[model samples]
Target: MEKEIKKVNDEISVAAFDPEENSFKSFAEKGFKSVINLQTDEEEQNVSPEKEEALAKDNDLEYRHIGVSEDKLSEALVDNFRQELENLPKPIVVHCKSGKRSGALVMMHIGCDKDMSGEEVIKQAEDMGFECDVPELEQFLKKYVNEH
Candidate 1:
C-alpha cells in the first residue's frame, strides 16, 4: 500500500491490488480506519467484495464499496465517491486491480476539489506513478478535470 496524506482533508492509501485476508488485519494493526474499494463485482480478483467487507468489519474497520469500471467512471461516480469519502472514517485505504484506478480517482478528486487544472492532475498522476492507460479513464479524466 502507498500512503499519502493531503492537506485538503483525507489521509488516503492506495493499494497495488485487492487486499488479502492477512492484509485486512495488517491495515487494522497499522491504524487504518476505513477501506474504500473501487472495483466492480464483474472484475473478479482474489477475494469477493462481500468477503472483503466481512474481513474489514471483522477487523473493526469501516468498509465501503464503490463499483468503478470502464463504463462506470463518471462525474457522478466520482461525486458519489466524494460523498462516501466525506462520511467514511479518515486514514482510508482505497484499492482496485492495479492501483491505477484508485490513484486516478483520488487525484481527480483532489484536482476538482482544489480547482487544479487537468494538466496539473495529469502531471501529478505521472509523478505519483498512476497510469491512465485505459482509453476510457484517460478520456474521462481529461474531460472532467477540465470541465469541473
Candidate 2:
C-alpha cells in the first residue's frame, strides 16, 4: 500500500504521493474539495486531465491541473499558479510525482502567502528536494510581498 504524506492546516491540506489512477475514488471518500497537480507534459509525465476531471466530478472535488517544474519554475508559470492559489478554496491538496514540485510550489506560495523571504522559501524547497537552478526565484520572492 502506498502512503500519502499529509500536511493539514486550516488553509490547506496537502498530500504527497502518486495518486492512483483510481485515487479519485479515495478522494471522494476523503471529502477533499480540490486538487492542484504539478506534473507537466514537458517532462512527458502527463496524467490524464480528462480522467482526473471525471474522477473529480464523481468525487465532487474541484480539480485544477497546473504544471510545475522543479528545476525551473518560470515567472509566468509561477504567477499563473499564484493566481490559482488565490482562487482555490481553502484546504486544497497540491501534488506531483515525488512531492518535489508540490513542495516548490508550496514554497513559492509561502513566500507570497506568509511574507517569507526568498532564502527562507528556498530553504523550505531544499528541505523537500527542489534545487533552485535560477536566480529568478529570489527576485520573485522579493516582489511577492509587495504585490500579491
Candidate 3:
C-alpha cells in the first residue's frame, strides 16, 4: 500500500505501484469496491487469478482479472475491459505490474467516456506519467478513442 491510488475520473482509480497478495485489505480499507488486475498470469511473481479473487472476496471486494499482456493488447481486449468496468461496482482500483497497462486502458476508457480526441487522451495520459510508449499499444489506444 505504499503507492498512491491515483484518481482516474470519478469511479475509476489506479494504484501507482503493483499490489501484492496482501494488499487487498488495504484496498478495502481505502474504499475500493472492485479490483481490476491487468497483469498476465505468465508474468513473474503474479499469484493465481483464483487466489487473488479469493483474497478479494475475503476482503469483501469484487475482483476481476482482465489480463492483457503487452504483446497481446487488442481492440477486443479493450472493449472487454470497458464492458467489465461498466458492469463492476464503482470506485474500482486498476493495477498492473508497473501501472502502465492500467493507465493505458484507463486513458482509452476515459477518452471515450469524456469524448476526448486521440491526441487529447494521449496527452492526458502523458501528463499523468502514464504514456503508452509502445507503438502498437499507442495505435490500439488511439484507434479505440477514435472509433468509440
Q: Compute each candidate's TM-score over C-alphas.
A: 0.89, 0.74, 0.93
- What are the per-residue Cα lDDT tens digits for candidate 3 across 35-141? 99998888874567788899999999999998888788888999999998999999999988877889989999999999998889999999987867788888878
User: Candidate 1 — which residues are off by over 4 angstroms?
Assistant: 1-10
Candidate 3 residue spans exceeding 4 A from truth: none
Ranking by TM-score: 3, 1, 2
| Candidate 3 to truth, TM | 0.93
Rate residue 112 of model 1 by lDDT: 83
lDDT tens per residue, model 1, 8-102: 23477787676678788888987889988988999877888999999999999999999998886778998888787778888888888788888
**Relative to the unseen true structure, what is the C-alpha lDDT of residue 141 in candidate 3, on a scale of 0 to 100?**
84
Better of 2 and 3 by TM-score: 3
Q: Which candidate has the top score in TM-score?
A: 3
Model 2 agreement with the true structure over 45-126: per-residue lDDT tens digits = 4356666767777777888888665455666887887777778766677777767567656676777777777667777666
- Angstrom error of the Cα, residue 23, model 1: value is 1.1
- RMSD per model, one decimal: 2.9, 3.5, 1.4
Candidate with more favorable, higher lDDT: 1 or 3: 3
The prediction achieving the highest lDDT against the true structure is 3
Clashes of 3: 0
